[model samples]
Target: MPSVNAPGLKRRKNRDGTERLYWAAPKSALAAGFPNRIVRLHFSAHDPAQHPLIEAACKRLEAEALEWTAGRRETRSAFDGTIASLVRQYQTDMASPYREVKWNTQRTYDQVLGVIEKAFGKRSLAALGISDFRRWYDEAKKPKAPGGSERVRKAHGIISMMRRMFAYGVTAELQECGRLLTILEKARFKQPGRRRQKLESHHVEAFIAKALDAGRQSLALGTALQFETTMRQRDVIGEWEPIPVAESAGGIVLGARRWVRGLTWADISDAFVVMKVTTKTGSEVAHDLTLCPLVMDLLARVPADRRIGPLIVDETAGRPYAEHAYAREWRLVARAAGIPDSVWNMDARAGGISEADDAGADLDAIRSAAGHSQASTTVRYVRGTIGKSRKVAELRKAHRNKS
Candidate 1:
């Protein structure tokens, strides 16, 4: 049993045989101390009745607690409670984004969040204004995904992410009172610069040779596959799904392409040296690509015992390469090959098209094999200046013979 000694103080005896003191602010001062108008004083049985120092210390503690409670601050300052912190919570919130987007899409947004955090992680949301956003927009280099197609820019792509985070802060009351929504409206994104770089002919031999020297067989094989087939990143290593088949006029059978699906080793015929694959263009269109000896040789590197599995593997994981992880592997291999930072899978397709042009393949032949919907699109891939020069010289010879 504990004896009550102090005024305006409540006492409770814990199971541990310790006495606790809590000061409950009266109804008149209900707005002070804590949200519940209660402040924890001390656990020891210190009497303020006789000790003036103890009584003064207790009064000071209560006053400080009340001040803190009035501000409604959980952290030291507004800097700790930031837009970056709010976005992180919104991303992982079980109620919203986690339930809305797929895992891969969520991963993509995480990259966007990372850039946002790096730039403004310490910025107080309450103090962020149009000038701060405009400065960020001018200075922020758009986050380009390692292998993804989306261009992440504060004004263009990442604005959606910014909008969502601010909106979440508002609904959750996590943000300090500010006009964050108004700043977002002022951003304008124009088209970014086009990428004109292409993987050249000599880079092919150098990359494969360097990859082999490093014992990176998976990268070497992945390179040849992308170069030969011109498949998109996911198509190279992604899982395959059975496409639906239907009968057409004259009892012809048509296998409709499923873009979401991918090609596997099971889709390849070693003897025929051809691959049938669902392409990125549409749901029903497919491509039948002729494989060269290089592609066949690369395919042979895979263990013969493997019957059916994802064709492209990380080797480290013994699984299909997640697009992001594979991009890292590609960069390492490219560095070993002495390829510049600008060269990527997009350039690999150009290498294949350039090879065809060097072999004197005409526009129609190149267009059909590359699956370009328009000649203009196919022409954009022609990077061999020597091949074009040779074609011009040959036409001059033919004109002289006609004269």
Candidate 2:
């Protein structure tokens, strides 16, 4: 029998003549030479399970030692040096592209990255498993904003980018590293309820009346023209132009055109208002709008000062308002007008489609006015009118019976 000699150690002989041993070294030995914990076993050559059991036990012991060693090493080299270096390189190289995104979008990415870095800063990217990623993703999905699902989707995008960076690092320098990174599957956050309220025509009229009464005729008319033209606020203020009074039958004619990089406005014959507009769908086509009397009168009242390159100027930047700046101002205007929190500026486009349909406008006309590629795209806007149509049909049937 081979006897155990270490202190605080035990050994027992099994019926098959194999031995199992457990030992605890002195605390001083941990710092001197030996680790605080150790295990050993010996078996006769005839034991069938001995080899497999010993192999598994050896692996477990090696893994524990590796974990302890990782803790004692320098923070930068704790993750085998390669992962740490890759993170530093990615942070350095991402500055320019990150800056090009909108400020709000950049902020969101920054916040998500901060959370992920804080959680796994000391861990090796190659060592990351799917379980760790699930934990992080679940934490990120807790915040419920109006577009919470979209926000969480963007967070997942950031994670995907990080994973790609690590993969690139592995291929470039860690060729000998055999471990595969486990990435979390893409997950979508739950969508919040739609709280959007459609602005009625009467509400639009009231807003116009208030603006005109306040001597802010230009702002009033601009807002009205935006609703009538179904132009986004960015397109409306960025592309305002004056119309010519020539050949005026009843009202002056004005035209605005959106160029490739900029916008232009000109006055043509009173019979036609022509402008080259780049629609949101990326089609560069000329739009011929018939100038209404109200639109012409509104154009005449626009002050000379507001008649810079575009109708709206960024007072802070002293240039044509960028989309972000205009969107901010539009939000303030909507709030001041007592617009419901649920309603957004896009509702105006919906309202315009509804108005055109009520006036018996052709589907093609509605599609052109709304700048949609297909008339089917405009069909969604009139879906609410199905109820009205049913009621009208019932009334017509009753009237026919009485006749």
Candidate 3:
């Protein structure tokens, strides 16, 4: 009776006594070339069974009208059958592995893919060869600015992504991709050495002090949690993802932000242990919080009433921090503590592993604590074999003394 009471929604009654819903695009939308003057909706406004359908249509049309007026086009880039086209294909094709990866990983892949598209998008796959790639590799690894150091890691990432893309092409049974893969197989690229920087105890202490002084308790807790439990920053702070149109269901508007799973208070046990599965490896890890005095102290400071939902909430947003915001805020606190830019928040996991090894903890035990599926993965985070070497030296001296 109230014409569905939504913007751009109206009711039309037929002489046959049937009522149907119609959407009227606003003048602004009309000026922007709206598709039609009045779009008839499939649902009837008078039917209680169809009211939900009418409501959904109304909202969708309203959003469409807004977007049309805002000049936002959802057009796809044309495919020219070049490397850029292939990249787009890999990204959009449902069967492509790129479509199946986690969002964070997709973001990483996009960074490298963007570089590939920009550099060689116009070049035909048949024209690219080992020589072209080798020359590009040399140029990419060079310093971007005068007096700046070379970007070996960044260059290495590009090469690695290219290899994967070519391999993907072979999987898709593209003859050109198969040839490219064969060529790539014969090439060797510069491999950057593993990172040696580990989070030091002083760095942790300073970060905590600085974060607390700035009144960012969540960040202080996050730092201690990451350093002590060997958990990733994403596992602690959570991530923001777009709410799908079909699943938007209310509260958070469609196309806005929604929180993915992260560390929740329910993950903690009565013994002050954090037990949860790692997001990356899907391996369950249990960390005894009582053993980590810093982490425990920070947890204790949180009021009982606030100790609910996500363990780490960005006070500014009253919700979990997005990945970028988390890093930016962490960097600010880190800079205040005089921590160098070379050392990242991610290095905290490595710092914890190094500390555990240095304390003479068993290798297998450390591996389990880090939630690594293989011992080798955990070993990479140990930074150095200083602890193992010290133990070997002590054993040698003892044998000599006995003799």
Candidate 4:
């Protein structure tokens, strides 16, 4: 909030043609706890008109900064403690190496940030107490999800992130911030059930056919690739490209470059090929590309020049397709096919494994295909949602087939 042109400011021009602004707080001012730092001005020193503006900024900083620094850091008022401001301050440290976050985790944080801003962005952090959090939890309704357990979870995450931010504020030596988390104890969270979005093999065939018929060749192929390889959407979403073939010490190297987690076009070019896929749990599975006729056929429909590019791409725009576009395309196809539009393209992978279960594939085989570190996790995917009888029938079919 303090400007570079504040009192006692000095300017320097560097060989790189950019200007720098530096101010030394009088030692007496520093003793009073003024935040002393250098400010690098992005403007060129050659600009003569900026001098007066710079001097005025320094004077204002000199005058206004003393009030904040003259005493101990004071508690921020509620109106001043806007969630947006809190998030900005928190993110300054989060971007620091000591607090770096993963890409996927950062995406979740961004989503939560929007929810917080919508609910209480303008509210002061210090003014909020137990009562306010309770009220937010009871009233939190996501724009798209109005009245479901999912809505409750979204509210829970928003409050949790607020609590996390306050914890960071406390770590930054702001007083009374950590105590505010106690207010969130009344916020209830939903215990989510096992996910049940899956498809049978026949259903997958129908979905792909309809998707292709709808003129979304890339979407159709991408969905089939997920099912055929049982890959997580991240790994399957246009990541696969052609790699140069060559002989290596151990065997054939699949590509000119290697990705520990990425697949190549060559990996799926044949009836069965060895390729490794990694999942969210940080484990990798080698897929022997079999049962992939549908995926291969869809690939053949793509233009030849684009074949070496991503498996799924926005060919009209000459770029990769957005994740939401994949789901939106699937919804269009589903609606046209008379299937539930609630089905997600992500469910195609689950369909592959569940179909494997129905077709009497070994649990370990399914587990390996799905790239789960723990086989028990794969077992959970096969759990029947509605009734035990459904699972019983599948087991009975496997038994009958063996006889």
Tens digits of per-residue lDDT, candidate 1, 1-403, equal 2444334566678899777665555453355434334444433555545344234435644554555656644542321356666666676655554448744567678888887888687786656766776566655544455654444344444566777777665555342422476567555645355456777657766888887787777777777766776555566666323353462323111233222344566766655344444345542323443446556676666678974655666677666665467778778888888899988866888777777887787887777777676778877787744776798999999999999
RMSD of 4: 15.3
Better of 1 and 4 by TM-score: 4
Ranking by TM-score: 3, 4, 1, 2
Question: Could you tell which candidate, 1 or 2, scores higher by TM-score?
Answer: 1
- Alpha-carbon deviation at 337 in model 1, angstroms: 2.3
Strongest candidate by lDDT: 3
Clash count (model 3, backbone only): 0
**Local lDDT at 325 for model 3:** 88
Q: List the candidates ranked by lDDT, beginning with the highest.
A: 3, 4, 1, 2
Tell me each candidate's TM-score.
0.49, 0.48, 0.77, 0.61
Off by over 4 Å in 2: 1-134, 143-195, 214-218, 239-264, 267-276, 285-288, 291-294, 303-308, 313-336, 354-368, 373-403
Off by over 4 Å in 4: 1-85, 94-99, 102-108, 121-129, 142-150, 166-174, 181-187, 191-194, 239-263, 266-271, 274-282, 296-307, 358-365, 374-380, 383-403
lDDT of 2 by residue, 1-403 (tens): 3332224444567799766654343454355433425443333324655545444444544454455545543232212333444455444443335535544455666675665566565675445555666666666555576644535664465566565555554443332122333233243334344333555566566656665665555445556656676665545555322233453332211233121223333322345463436435654434344544445666666665555454433556555554455556555555667776666666765776777777667778778876778888877776345444756788999999999
Please give the lDDT score at residue 375 for candidate 2: 81
RMSD to true structure for each model, in Å: 18.0, 14.7, 17.5, 15.3
* lDDT of predicted model 1: 0.61
Error of 1 at 309 (Å): 1.5
- Measured with C-alpha atoms, the lDDT of residue 395 in candidate 4 is 89
Q: In candidate 3, residue 350 scores what lDDT?
A: 95
- Candidate 1, position 65, lDDT: 52
